[model samples]
Target: MTEDQVLDEFRAAEALLEGHFILSSGLRSPRYLQCARVLMDPRRAARLTDALAATLPAELKIDAVVSPAMGGVIAGHEMGRSLGVPAMFLERPTGTFELRRGFRLEPGTRVLMMEDVVTTGLSSREAMKAIAAAGGTVVAAAALVDRSNGKAEFDVPFYPLIRLDVPSYAADALPPELAAIPAVKPGSRAIA
Candidate 1:
């Protein structure tokens, strides 16, 4: 499917959304791209993942696919399956995400990090660091939506199935449509 087609699918699956949402990046926007809406449908999810999988070069030699927990788990599994590699997800423990549950990346393992959406690339970076700490070499990063306009900082190549120019506003800068909604701070908080 084309980029436009993928975006159209995202629009069609709007039921997964709720009241004004503060993205993980701490940016305030009137809308949110709830990937679960598209991921819940196996057929559609396969199609979308296939499109993303095609962008990855065969020579990258990815040994496994890793993604941040919550939103990215399913997408990572789907992409890994499409690429015929094992998949794992990193979850937040304390204040940071780590490879838990006996998950370990062998030395010199080539890993590709996958995400459902790219806002500030904070979570992606954390996942990359974890992979590196485990001795895995990050070959690339993939996301379903790229809203950062390439501003995300990552040492590896980053690819998104859809590139969108969605601008975000701060709490005080939110438009009238979003001004009435309650504000929630973004970031992965630690549980004490």
Candidate 2:
């Protein structure tokens, strides 16, 4: 799907938000994509994820789809279905991400780390580390939206359904317009 089409889904779901927002990365932005709202509808989630999965290189072989809990769970599950692989998730019950609930990967299982959005790529990196610790190899990663604007980097091939150029700023350097509005955190993770 085109970028406009992808964003249209978010608009139709009312997941595309606007306001002073604190992202999971601790940065502030005027726009935020509330993926939970978009994925709340299973059909929309499937459509979005299927388009995202299609963006991956055809040569990429994924044995399983492992996503970080909360945001990535639904997208990752749908991605697994799109790829015809088993889907599992990592949970941070005690701060650090780890595979639990009888989820295990073979020593060299090829994994596709999935996420709802990639802002700073911190969560994606953390989740990839946990996947490694659990004996899976994260050969590639995918996300529904990449609001990083080509700034966030990953160790593996990264594919995103849409790349949004939403501007984000550090807390101390927010634009005057955004600074005037009270910030609300709409992500799953807490900022320090």
lDDT of 2 by residue, 43-99 (tens): 999998888887788777899999999999999999999999999999999999999
* Candidate 1 per-residue C-alpha lDDT over 45-122 given as tens digits, one digit per residue, 9 for 90 to 100: 888888999988888999999999988998999999889999999987666778998888999999999998888898
lDDT of 2 at 96: 98
C-alpha lDDT (0 to 100) for residue 167 of candidate 2: 94
Error of 1 at 32 (Å): 0.9
lDDT of each: 0.83, 0.93
Runs with alpha carbons beyond 4 Å of true place in candidate 1? 15-19, 180-192
List the candidate 2 regions with Cα displacement exceeding 4 Å.
none
User: How far off is residue 173 in model 2, in Å?
Assistant: 1.0
